[model samples]
Target: MHGGEPSVHFINSVLVTVVVALFVLWRYRLAILGGMRRGDSAFLPLPAERAPGRAVLADGDIAAREQAMRQRVAAAWLLTTAICSLPMAVAYMVAGKMSASPTYALALTCSYMIAALPMIAVSLAWPPWRMVIAFVVMMLSFAALCLLAGIIERSLLGRPLSWKILGLVPLFFDIAWNQLWMAGLFWLLSWPTRLRGVVPITFAAVLVFAAAPFAGSRLTAVLAATEVGTPWVYTLGLNGVFMLIALPVGWLAWLRLGKLAADYEAKRFSDAQLLARTWWLMLVVTIGFDILAGRERPTFALLLVVGEIVLFPLVNHWVMRWLGVAKLAAAKPAPTLLLLRVFGYTARTERLFDRVASRWRLLGPVTTIAAPDVTARTIDPGDYLRWLTGRIDDLFVTSRASLDAKLARLDLAPDPDGRFRINEFCCRDSTWQATVIELMLRADVVIMDVRGISAARLGCEFELQQLAKRLPPQRLVLVVDETTEREHLKAVFGPTLEQVRVIEIHRRRDADRAFEALVDAAGGAGSPPDAWSAGKKDGANQAAP
Candidate 1:
């Protein structure tokens, strides 16, 4: 008796909108989880590249350039990363059902919206449309690959078309789409061409697995999609199981980073190789185990920590080592007097070199031993190291008396010139820092007051690297406050501490042990710094004399 109108048909457009909204929400959660930071720009690029490493002219202060670069990164991150596509995705998904065919409706938004951020990601990170084209090629290639795999597996296994359609076919399609999802961020990352293939592939795998809800098969998927309780069952399918897998994966990755840090510290590898291995492993783990299964448990926090191990190093290159963010941090926000410099004759080329070497060497042998890298503008790793390792209590003493005792126990060699060449500097009259370094280098019986210095600060590492190059670890009495340890130092410095001689003085009894500790740490009766002692008596005594 009652018939539906033939001219008009209604679909659950509201429901479709709700689904799109959910998808957008999920993406926002992921983006926030992954990259929310103090200066995040969400979807925009930094205003400019970080400052130049060093000033090319008095006209160009590289630090200024670096500031601009950071701003650009922040802005771009905000403008493109998580914001733009999400709102649009929700809008289109919501509007699709009410407007027409649900499939077409979503395609209109999904195709265009999905392409939006990814296009930006590739362009910014790699430039020249190289990665963009690469992505397209890779996507097509992957689709072909899946088709080939399906043909092969189908033929060999002799599985029914039902199995092929429901299982393998969907799996391959999922993987292909997942890759596209991964390639969406080249602009955001500014990655090299060489590195794209693996990361996107891995990312694709993770996404497919994560999207298990939508990828099952004809009967299974339809039931799951519309059966209300099907989602609950499917979610239960592997999330719990994957949590167990994720825990160990995260742990292994964390250990790997530590080993890498050590290898670099000990000069056992090149920086490029060191960083590459770390990155490759992380990418694999991020996609293979971390992304899909990781999100389902507290393991994500652990994964975040592991991510920090990788992220810290990158941050170091972009914002610290090359960006010189540490220099900026040390910069007196108001310009009070962080850098003590002296100009003219005060500048000792050797001593200045020594200080620079000492302060930064802790970053690792990769930096210290790498081919000389000079730039007009660059970020240094100081900020990055500090952020990752925190402060390692490398130096300490049991007691002041013990420290004194240790110093007394040292085989105090007679200073023929009453001075020691602790380090060399190319100091100049105008550079007060050079003047100070020169004085320190020329002082005999130098007591390295490593009081507040943490391995995180490039300052201590720089000094230590130079010391290793110059007098050896023994001649330098590393006076720690007694609350430090070798492991703590090693953790902070990665493997750079292999050459160090540590002495902790928590009590006065340790004093007599001090001198012997240094020599022992240095590995023998090495020749001391090549400089005479400061033989003059106290200022008052000299005045009276």
Candidate 2:
């Protein structure tokens, strides 16, 4: 088609593959490495002993800091959402061929609002389904709003309302295709990690990337019937170009991810820093998309819009860090709240943790034993990646001395969003019992969710016994649901069951009440009840249900 310049279709096809590959590695990282077995590498020698620094704060100062941290995080979320919308606003102006006028300003403002709505809504939710529901509801609402706005504008201008408004329905599908392939690529990445499961699906995404140009040309041929389909040779050349570009790009990102993962394991980088670095890499790749946009590229507008959406979370993260929200929360230490739950309740337990941590700052840092099933939901991508690479043989502490050292090195620091970086005990089957006992002794307050507990889960039964034996009645909160085996609780806790705060969570409000009870139990840890209650009253009152 040209002497030197690549066709827009070829450029965009390559961009899509590269973006899909990067995102798979970024967001679905745990899924990719889910199949790898734990390594058996010997533990490295412990680092030289150093006293951990302690920060002292007055009760008033602690409350003030917690309040200030929440405010900063909220501000950062709003500001980042606005900032991410700018790329889309400018894209609309450029693509629509509009000048800088009141009309353009209105378009920009509307675009900003539309782009910001879903993310802001999702951030307020705890459960994964709630987040998805929030996003979908906002998108549908925005679509309706757009149609109404268009109709009103056309009527004011004495113009007819055209059928083009109906295109919005298909437009959603178009955007959804982007998310679909991102999901597909992620799923494919996971398949190859499993030795036996490796098959054509592992390479399907790569092949799709390579064939994107031919696919695009075929669609163009169908839509514009007069135009010729791309020649087979041209298609092969585009595929080669895709491989040439994607291989090195993916490899470089892979190596960077591996290094970051190792460094995170070694504690060379904090979770927030690892996230910041990863996002910066994503931004770099996205910049490459803009560079490919070049001059008069038709796909550039949609590319910009999609890129803004992709970068929204990253921008929010960086904004919060820049605003010192993480630092503020990390400044003062509180008693650790140890969490245990039934293995089946992975998603629900994660949501509960989110609720408890987000609602009250007085609960301090949350710690838990990391079951493999919960790794994807709980652990940082870097550590998960390291585990996948078989570089984490020392993941679980094998001895009491080693366990103590690990505990001492725990980073109780919260992330930029104010969720405490969970100090998870990555324990082996043999070591988990000891790990639980140690953690139980150290934990200021314990919340064990035995919702689905039964005779089948002997491990949970053991945990229940340890909690009852190690922790006092006020220091532990037992969460049970209807599915809980009444006999197990009666047999284990016996007389202690009456004194223990047992909260049954069958509904959302029950969970909220349970969360409050958990926080109150946590207040019993190392702080006078009145002082803790006074400090947390405002936060609890304002907390989202």
Candidate 3:
């Protein structure tokens, strides 16, 4: 081998290794950082805390800052890789890798770099549709490069140029198939996080497999033309062996990576399982399409179709059943006590309450029913009646007299299980006050989130007042952010604040402990009496404040 060939081989191999390593590192950088923060053995352990003599930063703040820095560094590294690919390709060509005039490899590499730049730039936030457009641009760019390379090669060979350019079809298929392979591998490794939508993966697989037969034929033709000593069987066998080795290795690596991610983020494993199901379905469909549409043996294809028709449903059902089993095995037992969550209806407040609730699962299933906004206009009588009847027209009342008769017929029965089943009221419905009052009067425990309350909340404050009057103070657990002023709490509850149990969340970190304490306190309280029927009658007559 010549010096140039060795240099070409070295550069190409280094480029491939570097790209793969960097891509994997970028994809899992967050998980790796989390592992480091958690002192997992897989990641480099953090340095010991500074000596008492030295000023020390909070470990959480340090970890957060480091995570942010790592994310920026990863993004920069990926951007650098895309930018450097072009120069590396040029160097490869200069090393005589592109000695076959018109340099298809060089063209392909340049086109890929061009396509990769925008993708890496937006990979973190771009939706699936945008990714599809980006891939289309890449394919078009690659085809253009191939056509240009083909023209140049023909000119160099002193061959008469004609519309024989159509002969580049094989090269197009080859390029497309390779792109699909790159995309598929990236998606497989990235799994649920990097690719949010299933459509792109499905389309890419379909296109690649559709082009595979033609690409395979083209490869065989090229091999024969080159008269390489290797037999076709040996070449095919080598590819089979490579796949057989690579698939298991790749799968194990993916699982390991996914495990790290799931350790860092609870939802990652569930998302991965969902994406796996989607990919499996895609694979089955792709294989069926190939057999039915591409195979030459019609009878065999028909038989295969018939068999698939019978087996696919069974296989699908089995997979679903297995998923359900896995989920049950993984889940913790459901809590016995059901706690109702009442909070200011804002995104920030809801998220904070949800986070707190999730941490205090021992408390029970937290049901958040948005308290009615009495500041809004009253609901139409027709809508109110519909809501009152549970959206059913079982009692047809044509006139006001008949409607009154139906109202008299209405039964305000309490839940027999004493389960306090509170319907999720629509935000637009102003009659939610009556529903909230009914549920609060019957709830075992009421978790009041008074974090951002400055003045009294119309519906919530009134409900709290009623709850304090009817239910014991122990059953009403008030959650206030430390930042909330004492004056604000007094304004909401008046002098009755002395009786209720208050849990103050001093910081985000303290929320879990505060919530857990609230749960314990709430659990000790006796269940409220069945006040729904009495409360409903009173609530029907009273106007919402």
**Predicted model with the maximum lDDT:** 2
* Candidate 2 Cα deviation (angstroms), residue 353: 4.8
Q: Tell me which of candidates 1 and 2 scores higher on TM-score.
A: 2
Cα-based lDDT at residue 131, candidate 2 = 49
Ranking by TM-score: 2, 3, 1
In the range 353-448, model 3's lDDT, one tens digit per residue, is 334443332122333343322101112222222332354222222233433353343222211111111122222122334434544543445666
Question: Candidate 3, which segments miss by more than 4 Å at Cα?
Answer: 1-345, 358-364, 370-423, 427-430, 456-459, 494-499, 525-545
Error of 2 at 240 (Å): 8.2
TM-score (all chains, Cα) for each model: 0.23, 0.60, 0.32
* Stronger candidate by lDDT (1 vs 2): 2
Worst 10 residues of 3 by lDDT: 414-423
Clashes of each: 146, 0, 0
Residue-level lDDT of model 1, residues 1-545, one tens digit each, is: 01121001111221232343334334332332232222321222112222212111222232343344334433333233223323333443342324433333233223322333332332222233444685576445444445555555666777655544335434544643552333333223423332222232223223333333222322353545677848754765555435534555555544544554454344343232232332333333333232334233334434443554454334323432343333433332111001111112122211322232221211111011100111100111221122235421111112334233422432212111111111111111122222233223322223343433543433455444433434333334554442334444445434434434334443333333443433232233443232111111111132210
Q: Write the per-residue lDDT of candidate 2 for residues 1-545, one digit (tens) a residue.
A: 22113334433444454455445444333432332223333433433323322223335244355457556755665577457655655655565566654333333443344333322322332444554675577557655655566567668878877798667555544543432333233223332211111111112233334444444444444544433434533554545544645666556556555665565555443443333332322332333334344434435634663575467657776787788766676666666777888775645775666565434433366678876444544455445455446655455666557678888877665545654556777764455677677677766677788777767766587788766766676777777765678777779766666666666665454566666566556544332343223323423444333
Better of 2 and 3 by TM-score: 2
> Root-mean-square deviation of each candidate, in angstroms?
24.6, 10.2, 23.9
Candidates' lDDT values, in order?
Answer: 0.31, 0.52, 0.40
lDDT of predicted model 1: 0.31
TM-score of 1: 0.23
